[model samples]
Target: MEERLIMDLVPGLEGIPAAESAISYIDGDEGILEYRGIPIETLAVKSNFIEVAYLLIFGELPDRDEYERFKSDVTYHTRLKLKILRMMEWLPENGHPMHYLQAVTSAMGMYYPARDTLDEEVRYWSAVRLIAKLPTIVAASHRLKHGDEPIKPRNDLSFAANFYYMLFEREPLPLVERILDTMLTLHADHTMNASTFSSRVVGSTLADPYTIVSSAIGTLSGPLHGGANEEVVRMLAEIGTKENVRPYIEARLERKEKIMGIGHRVYKTRDPRGEVLKGFIEELIAHKDIDSGVFELSKEVELVVAERLTGKNLHPNVDFYSGIVFNGMGIPTDLFTPIFAMGRVAGWLAHWMEQLKTNRIYRPTQKYIGKRKEPYIPMEERKRATAR
Candidate 1:
């Protein structure tokens, strides 16, 4: 006799291997993250965002000539076409930045067709254009929503510095530019994150890179994945004073509620990205002459949460300190996730490239739990049954 086989369903596919990827790695228990075999800590401190982006997408660090060429391509492509800019003007001003990002990104497919996902040239240019234009789109979204004309990207500025300039029409201070670049490197990729997973899934169908990235952007817009940084800032604001930190955390704990930014699904220990941002927060506060109230409050919350929750491996994640850093830089809270999308797009494109190599449309099996079969009644029969 032959035996039937069954598989247990895993909720959210937790701990299941979706694909064999060499793009990024995470060891939750050890609190390690790497992009293409380089430790995130090293990249965050030693490399700029563009370099890190090239490394992620190409699976190796670029030499001087390669870096210059890639950088030049990205820099040259940063400006949106006039029609795309006109389209942005018509979007509802009150919509979230992520929506603007998603719409514009998806529309890019119409303007720059990449239907041949297998063509190397098509993939290369698509990656360049998406990486280059996302910051421009994000900056434009923020400005247009506020009834302000969007600023243009400056080719002379470094990638991170240009983003800052486009957003505010002024170059970032030296330290701010460095921190923003590091933050981008830190967020460039993470293994099997929701957005990366979405990218791979969509890319499996050989979809154009723009559509793949736009799908990933939509996934990242969900609060569970990308909104924690904004929530962390809000939590700090509500705490309002160092004295309130412990009580507020305890109250939330007692009610079995989440402490925003205090935990991560993948990191059972301190998130390595959070540690890097934490150090930067300290450095920025001490040297930059900015208001440090949020930093101090964040420290208190960390201390309190550490004392109470670290036993369960619920320590602060990347969002914890990233919010403090962005808040200190005077970034509006709503732009946090959109900025996250900007960095994670590198990962999305990398995964999209990887997914095409072993393309298989994702078709996971489902366990059916609903009624198997039911006869459809004619309209008169249904009416008689209702009457009865």
Candidate 2:
């Protein structure tokens, strides 16, 4: 038996190359990010989010013809099934949209059953339906909860713009639309994070794609995972100002409490996604002229926390700045995680497709500690005998 828990195995798992990928490298020490051998900074600055999605799914940047086809396919499938829209309406308004999304995603598998043949055309349609409808479902849920009528998707608009327009019932400002697009591109994929791993594990069993994605969403709903940004926003709100940040962080550090969004399981130094989001947050803040005092306070907290926990090697992750950007975009606090789902579903689908290509059942080994041999005893008889 192993004498101690091997925590370092977190990064280096045998036979699981999913965790480590040269395809998209995150250099945490230097705060650099790259996707498919291209620097993330360049993509964020130059490419639109839909283009990035195409890159992740197809493994190369699409040329004009391929890009047009991809966009057309996505746009054609953006409209939800009428039955699914009715189901969305039946969902409780106050309930978390992620829960609704999970249920809806799982339910989608039932609506679109996989054929025995499993032809390439079938798989292609499945991919299109998932990628296009996900944002529509999420945005519609947002509007539905707020007692507003869900806006129909505009085929002419880009995916990000359509999502924003649907949620707000008006055209988004050009800069805001671009920022949202960049954010979606940045989040389109990462190598097998917890939720992506969950999706892949399910897909390995040859389960329906919707079921796999639903499982992924359930995993991401946890606070330690996708929901951290919501908590980060609340934490910043509680801190209220730059002056309160140091004292608040000091108090939390004294208690050994985790400052939400300040740590990650994979990245040792800094999250590359965090760097991109920090820039977006700054842009949004300046564009909106919202004096939230969050950016200054967050910077102070990051500096002080790094100084305090030297050996822990913790830093602000992607979730740190994402909430601020969402808040700046006029998004409510509760809807943050659901918005994360909008971008993450693409990655989930990509992993699902990859898993299906090399079909295998995922069964992990567990370290069990129990009696090697045990005799069953009659509970009533043993208790009576003991009393006597």
Candidate 3:
């Protein structure tokens, strides 16, 4: 028998290794991120979202024939069931996008009957189905929430372009399409993030892929996680202009409150994905005119914040400039995190499939901090004791 070490308690299980994965690696101290040993920058510049998705879920970059087949499969499965489209209209218009996404994603399991939970081919195809369908679901939900009609999917378009088309029913500019592709690639996987962890935990129970991923979507919906970029955009809007950026930081400093997009939990330096997004923002700036002040305000705020936090080892994460990039793309703020889920579903499915291969239930030992064996007394006796 293997001896288990009695280790010191670490709150939130930070820095704990829960599972072995060959999917992604991050050197937070060096501000590095790689998918299957390929640097994020390389993938951002050289790979589209589908290509990266293949790399993440399959463990290697695909060749031409393989990629073509994968693309074909994904394209073929992009359309939602008629029932799913109708289902979105029933949701309250004011419901948060993440909540709708979570609910609808859970419904996928019911909508499409699973053949086998443990079968390898069944699970892989399930991953492919999710990668293909989440965009349709998100886009359909977007249109339904606003009383607009949903657009059908097109195989001729690239993965990013297809989602753009689905959302607006028009082809995105070439640059915008490419930028969204890189954005999705960058977000495809990280080293066991909160959502991915939730995915693994659920999958450990031998749950179906949709249920596992739905659990992950719920975990990712928190403000501190996937919603951070949405908050960043809101912060920039509140700052209003370059002049106000300084005062805004100073006041937030006085309160010692968190400045959204400024810091991340993992990377003590800068997030590598943030750098790639910043480069894309530069390209976007040169190619188009940004009417919103948020872009300029973000730049000025970054400079000020960087100067102020010189020794704190804090910097803008992926959330920092990503909101500005998406805002400029005309994506609504509420859809920001859902868009994140669309990209991240590939990773969630990857982790889910990986966990199933090992097939161990994730029952972790917890430190008991609450009162132990508190005696239950009769209600009248307890009330009389309280009176006494």
lDDT of each: 0.91, 0.77, 0.86
Kindly state the number of residue pairs that clash in model 1: 0
Writing each residue's lDDT as its tens digit, candidate 3 over 1-388 gives 9998856788878888999998899988989999889999999998888888888888889999999999899989998888887888889987888888899889999977664778777876788898999888888888888889989999899888999999999999898898888888888899878899999998888878889888999999987678888888888888987888899999998898888888777788779999998887767767654454556677898899988888999999998878888988888888888889888988887787777778799998877779888899988767653654
Better of 1 and 2 by lDDT: 1
Comparing candidate 2 with candidate 3, which one achieves the higher lDDT? 3
Q: What is the lDDT of candidate 3?
A: 0.86
Where does the lowest 10-residue lDDT sum fall in candidate 2?
6-15
- Which runs in model 2 stand beyond 4 Å of their true positions? 1-23, 115-118, 288-293, 296-314, 382-388
Residue pairs with backbone atoms closer than 3 Å in model 1 (clashes):
none
Residue 282's C-alpha lDDT in candidate 1?
81
lDDT of 2 by residue, 278-320 (tens): 7766665576545545666777777787788778878888887
RMSD per candidate (Å) reads 2.5, 4.3, 2.1
Q: Candidate 2 local accuracy as lDDT? A: 0.77
Give the per-residue lDDT of model 1 (tens digit) for 1-388: 8995648888989888999999999998999999988889988888889999999999999999999999999999999999999999999999999999999999999999999999999999999999999999999999999999999899999988999998999989898899988888888998897889999999999889999999999999999888889988988999999998889989999999998888787788769999899888888779756788888888888899889876687888899888989998888899999888889999999988988888899988988889867999888767553654
For all predicted structures, in order, the TM-scores are 0.95, 0.86, 0.95
